[model samples]
Target: MTTTPDAGLRQDRHLATEIPGPLSQALMARKDTAVARGVGTTMPVFAARAAGGVVEDVDGNVLIDLGSGIAVTTVGASAPRVVEAVEQQVREFTHTCFMVTPYEGYVAVAEQLNRLTPGTHEKRSVLFNSGAEAVENAVKIARAATGRSAVVAFDHAYHGRTNLTMALTAKAKPYKHGFGPFAPEVYRAPLSYPFRDGPDVDGGAAARRAIEVIEKQVGPENLAALVIEPIQGEGGFIVPAAGFLPALQEWCRDNGVVFIADEVQTGFARTGAMFASEHEGLVPDLLVSAKGIADGLPLAAVTGRAEIMDAAHAGGLGGTYGGNPLACAAALATIETITADGMIERAREIEALALARLERLRDADPRIGDVRGRGAMLAVELVDPATGAPDAELARSVAAAAHAQGVIVLVCGTYGNVLRFLPPLAISDAQLEDAFDVLAATFTELS
Candidate 1:
């Protein structure tokens, strides 16, 4: 998790043994034997301490982080404002259960979300504990408001792991493997993946395919809502074709469907905008916000048109720690920090810098098939040039080399061939340059 750059990143290595040395292996052995490893893992390194964009492992290797704690730490690690806010709130109270004893901190954060989420119309918001909860609530609001059932989610979409959201999600491996008998009335359709799109893959065509599926499977008259991520997150950072979102939105409005924008991974100024949906100027009936909402505290929200949000009965949308005081405090401070510090502009600047270096890397490495993404959220897809086939092994090698050299990275995509970078916006230009050099060296070494 991250807050703000409390101190310039310091790497104090006192390695007494190999990386993830003896002590860590013992911990892992215990963990595997006793704990369920059901969650998908990205890195094997265990954190001793972390701040800014650097993570100190138990072996004492200080690896420069590129994942940003899965996009939760936007301000930085150990940010003064976030720490101060959280500390003060903790001293006052941690949780009184917003449902039992309502507090103003929760109401204040809801007010902020109501004002910030797109649209000038009167809006309302409700808080939850996770992105999945917010997404689930969005569907509930739509279903309650529209009085219908079916949901339309796109291919490669990653909503959540909950049963209902598992139905909302498209991938079947870890999400839907044993979790059979998912919530019904959920249907999947092809997404507008520009990188994979060809002469036949226009927005109209993609929309037509989805529409046709909905028509044949679940009639539009029965479809209550269509949820989408303007920029797909776990599904390979696929930015939809220019006209795709607008086209789908028009279709939804025409069919009396509640349009839900799942901005769990894209919101809070991560994609060089307040929300990726703003990239196309499309407003949805409900907007889900989380991940970076509380600067790493477990806070999430559903902000949208008041009429649709109000359809749920009084007791329908309450949770134990739904709007925990400490989380609300962190959200207020995080929102203030992002806007007050001009973090969105900083986000765009970061995207430009990363895109340039990633493009250079792509140009030099034939194995690098494509470099694409928006803002600090960017990725490089690896492939075997001989047949234009996915090269997941090459990606693994590159990431391993980078990790060995004290720089961290992540890989995504259905075939696990895309390396995505999501460093904090507060990362220094020098850090970015060093990360690029580390990547370049990793490539050269792997070659």
Candidate 2:
């Protein structure tokens, strides 16, 4: 049921009301009363409908989308292929509980994931409902395989909110703050942040330092796995140097620990390659995939060396909705579109346009600290003019100003000063130019 990418979507804007309007305000008041207090807000812009690269808010404001719902909807929002696949799958059945009633869709998806992810060795895959679940299950597989309890993660890493992953995550504020009794035996080390950690220090040196830390702190032999994102997502799209991933993977082989690539945000052609890990040609022992897997359906996966994957008890990895038929069917369509519809090439084109705009900003302004990323997964770090401190406020202001001008942008970083662009690969050239122009205007306004 999966169709090809079609821009048959037309943008329509009707604003008889404020940005939030009256109805949305009422809904917000009720939402504030009922929704969890600690929830994070993204522009407070309530969406009524979205298709392609434009999202229509409840207030009828049509805004150009640059976030792609946190890098999930890569092919595009309400992509015909995705919608049709979901619709047809839902009509047939929503949930069969893959474990309870095995289906071909789930197996087909698993087969695709194993084949598509990095490496040519014999591989196996398990499906889950979220990136966090996939990550946790990968760790479970590593522990079961090695009979070791220690796990090592990098600083500035953003794994997930689960108790164990939270412990693995490096950021302290929202994700890990006050949420401890964090899982034990989790160790953190400094990762290569070339922009800030120092210019001379590249990936190889950082990898050595990280390995030393593990051997000294956790003892390499006792460690079960070293989980890292090929391109750190929430911690800023910090693309590690060319040699970093290969070095780390080598170390894992020398030592007896599994190498897990948490590609939840970097998978499905987000980084020009099929998987970000493939950018460096390093095959991780286990890879976690989700977000863009099902084109917005809740789905995730863990694919790895078959021996490591099969180490656990037969029923060790699964969830009730882990491989829902609806999600699985959608995954099939989404993967097919990404691989066959030339979305990966489009992702590179997006990078070319975004890099050009960001480079201009960098050349024109010192406040723009750095512009770094591959493919559509790009971000610009902001810094104070004189002191060179992270200009977090300016980043936030730019995002707000862009939103006011009918463009939605997302900002994130360990220092809270980077504006990341993760637009859908199916986004058009004109839309990309329009988005760049809006960002340029905002930069001038802010200056």
lDDT of 2 by residue, 250-366 (tens): 999988889999999999999999899888888899999999999899999999999999999988778888888988888888887887789999999899988998999899999
Give the Å shift of residue 187 in candidate 1.
0.5
Top-lDDT structure, candidate number: 2
Per-prediction TM-score to the true structure, in the order listed:
0.95, 0.97
Worst 10 residues of 1 by lDDT: 8-17
Looking at candidate 2, what is the lDDT of residue 221? 79
User: Candidate 2 clash total?
Assistant: 0
Error of 1 at 260 (Å): 0.7
Residue-pair clashes per candidate: 2, 0
Residue-by-residue lDDT tens digits, candidate 1, 190-263: 88887777667887787777778877888888999999999888888888877888888998889899999999
